[model samples]
Target: MSKPLRVGVAGLGVVGASLARLLQRQSEALASRTGRAIVVTAVSARDRARDRGLDLNGVAFFDDPRALAGSESIDVFVELMGGADGPAYDSVKAALNSGKPVVTANKALIAKHGLELARLAEEKGLAFAFESSVAGGVPIIKTLREGLAGNSIRRIYGILNGTCNYILSKMETDGLSFEECLKEAQRLGYAEADPTFDVGGFDTAHKLAILASLAFGTAIDAEAIHVEGIETITQDDLAAADELGFRIKLLGVAERTARGVEQRVHPTMVAKSTAIAQVMGVLNAVTIDADAVGELTLVGPGAGGDATASAVAADIVDIARGVAIQPFGRPAHMLEEVERIPMQRHEGGYYVRLMVVDRPGAMAAIATRMGERKISLESIMQKGGARLARRRTDPPPAEGAPETVRVVLITHATSEQAIREALDLALADGVVTQKPQVIRIERE
Candidate 1:
């Protein structure tokens, strides 16, 4: 019998508890797979008296997660605690400084501080891995770092947040308002009570930062990426998108451009026939465009206890087998510094929805503004005002006069700043009722 590979886990929440149970139940299989008995020898969490439904037996317990990191009872420290700072950061730093391998699912910590930690781990010749940091159960990190190592990756993007995806999906299929869908998402545990981090696109941005580092061999730059939330997205946007032969998804897109690396998180209008558009509910899909692989997409459940735990367990198994890969594929020190492309300079097609008063020459005024910015229109349609039409509360359209007209326009590829300037000119001209809705269009 081989010696048992001791493991200590911090933060026994949903994914944390599931990982412990998985290691216990699949002990024999894991041992057979790795030629070593993987055992949970110690654990740490907030509530010691709280029942996690797992038999602790003789496993040691620690109140402070940082203490558990350097304990003599464990070989590798597993970090399930989230957040960019505080206990999670302190404990992870402790474990790495003590020369122990670390397997974490902390995307925020990785995006914000991954380069520093990776350097520390490499300095000490210890493995530092975070396979579960992005896209839950998908082997996206491995795919980008190793599987596609032979190829030069051109771009990588995806529906990375399950909560946002679920909300958007519900809004599309059931034709519900954004607020209504958000409430249901919270009730179902798909979203937090305070869902700003997920819905606001920061969650996906964190994941994208990590992915961008691996895919582009650059230092992690989470803050540099452009971010836009889906909070402004409405059922009317979906209906208009359906009519335009497109599906709206909140996407985190990263690509190597002529200027530099471009990273953005925003609601994207993908064609209805595309694979990413077809993915619905809480599921996720990542599309990678590389020279050798062409375009490869991996789709699966992006979140959940068992699915995420499985990813954590896979990292532990690799460590147990004495397999060590670079934290970001290439040596962290060798990662290049690339210019961060500004969102305002991004060129893409756009979907614009505005409610303008049905006054003579209103259409001409809108078209003139767009033309001044060199924006070309792919298509334009005017429809009856929405039921909840009056977003700006514009005094019920003045009784006897023509009702407010809803206009939807699809623009050809143009810079974001140009569109904003054109829209600003139109809005300032007093043609639009309130703010206009804008959604970027993604061809693939």
Candidate 2:
């Protein structure tokens, strides 16, 4: 029998507990496959007395996560603590510096400080794995780092956030308002109480930034990606999208364009017939377009206790088997600085909903402005008897006999700058009553 590989888990939250249970349950199978027994020797969390619904009688418990990171009994550190710069960062760094392999499910940490951490881990010659960081349980990091390493990836995009997906799916399926869907999601434990990170698109941006680095062989640039949430998506916008044979999905897209790397997270319009459009509810899907492989899409649960833990456990098993790979699919020194493309240079179809005064020449004025910008409309719909409904303290539209008309336009591929300019002109011309809502159309 070979020696046992000792593993330490930090944070006994849902993910941590699931990881611990998996390590114990899959011990014999893992030992047979890896030629070593994987053991969970220690665990850490703030509230040690709280029942984790698992027996931790044999494992050592520590209040300070750093203690588990430096424990002599453990050979690998599994970080499930959910912060970017707190004890999670401190413990993972400590473990790597101590010459132990580290695996983490912290996407925020990986997205924000991945380059620095990769450099440090590579400098120490330790395995720094974060397969669970993006698209939970999908093994996307492994796919990009090894499975498709031969191809030159042109683009990587996906529906990365599950909370936003749940909200959008509910709005489209149930015809419920955004606020109503959000409240339901919160009650169902799909969204956080605040829900700012997931719904605001920052969470998806964080995951996409990491994927962009892996696909492009560049440094992680979370702050550079353009992000827009789905909070502003109204029932009218959903109806307009449905009428046009498209579904609205909050997508994080990273593409290698002629200008540079275009990384953005926004409400996107995908064709209803596409597979990505069918990936509804709380599921995530990532599509990679490589030079040789063409396009491949991986879809699965984005986040949950068991699914995320499975990914973390896979990383741990790989480490136990002595499978070593570069952090960003290449040597840290060889990774190039990402040249971020400006959002204005982005070319894509758009879904625009304009609240216009129902009168002659207003529609023509919009058409003229779009024509001036070289943006041709694919379809337009005018919703009648639609009035701006104010909730609580939100001020109503300025008093006018102006009949409310919702003009939805599906535009051909055009520069974002031109769209903004055209929208500005339409608003200034008094043709539009409110700021025109624009959603980018992604051709998958």
Candidate 3:
């Protein structure tokens, strides 16, 4: 067997500790599989005194992660430090400059600085692996970078964030409001106190950016992703989705279009019969649409100490086995600049929920507005009477004023421009009482 692959891990958090334990426990099996003994030789973290319950007996500890990254003792650097810049970025760069193979689970770092890092790795002919950066433990990265290499991928979409998924699934299953589910998620440790990063759709946007780059061989353009959170999703919308034979999920979608590659993270209405719709709770799912594979979905735990560590281990094993695949499936210079398709030009069916005054002319006015834009409606259903009006955030009706009712319209395939124009016209016509809820529908 070749010399043992010495590993230095920075950041002894949940994933870091889990990875150490896994490397220790699976050392023999991994060695037999990879033709090299993989060993953890050094580690760095903020609080060395913190009891992570891992035996770092023979491992050296570094006060500075950069020092560990550039250490002569380790052949590989595993960065579990979570950040797009600062230490995570600095340490990873240090390791690459020191001619070490790199593995990471930091999505933010990869999404933001992937190109630069990939260029460095490519120039050095070293592997830069980040299998755990997106959907944890699902191996979507390997599936895209290797398994589906022979096919032309048409689309890739998934429930990429577990915190958001947990909240959404909780809301749908228990009929709780968004806030209630969020609080529950926090209590369950699925969400942080400041949940904006995850709940506000930025987290999924980061993951989606990475996936889009791999699936399309495009440069990672996170800023180009059209993002929307599940903050506005309500029980009314969920109920309406059920009636329409659909389920609401926070999805990050990247696909080919005539204009360009379209990447979006939003609350989407997917048909219940689809594989993605069946994923619930904190589990993550990614569906790839390719010419050869047709449609494929991979579902598993999106986040957890063990699951993410498993992915990190897989990347380390590949490195140990002397696999040198490009970070984004293609050579860094070969990655094409993504032609970003604007959301307004997006073509899709839509679910438009309007809270309109309970009057005869209101429905007609809305229909006319849609008709003016040539938007075809699949169905128009009024949900409940005046007593069932008013959204959670809607102020109570003024005394003696006309009450409101929810009018949901499912439109046939149309451009986003047309839908926005129609909704704006309806609002101007004094038909829509509150801001309308418009969710893009994914038929598959």
Q: Which numbered prediction scores highest in lDDT against the true structure?
A: 3
lDDT of 2 by residue, 58-177 (tens): 899988999889889899999998899989899999999888999999999998778888999999988999999998888898998899989999988899999999999999999888
Candidate 2, residue 131: the lDDT equals 95
- The C-alpha lDDT values of all candidates are 0.91, 0.89, 0.94
RMSD of each: 2.1, 2.2, 1.3
| TM-score on alpha carbons, each prediction | 0.96, 0.96, 0.98
lDDT of 1 at 112: 86
User: Against the true structure, candidate 1 has what lDDT?
Assistant: 0.91
Per-residue CA lDDT of model 1 for 347-367, tens digit only, reads 989999998877888989999
Give the alpha carbon lDDT tens digit for every residue of 1-444 in model 3: 899999999988989999999999999899999999999999999998888899888889999999999999999999998999999999999999999999999999999999999999999999999999998889999999999999999999999999998998999899999999999999999999999999999999999999999999999999999999999998999999999999999999999987889999999999999999999999999999999989999999999989999999999999998898999999999999998788999999999998898887878888888999999999999867877655657677899877889889999999999999999988888878778999999877
Pairs of residues clashing in candidate 3: none
The backbone clash count of each candidate, in order, is 0, 0, 0
Candidate 1 colliding pairs: none
Q: Lowest lDDT 10-mer window, candidate 1?
A: 385-394
TM-score of 3: 0.98
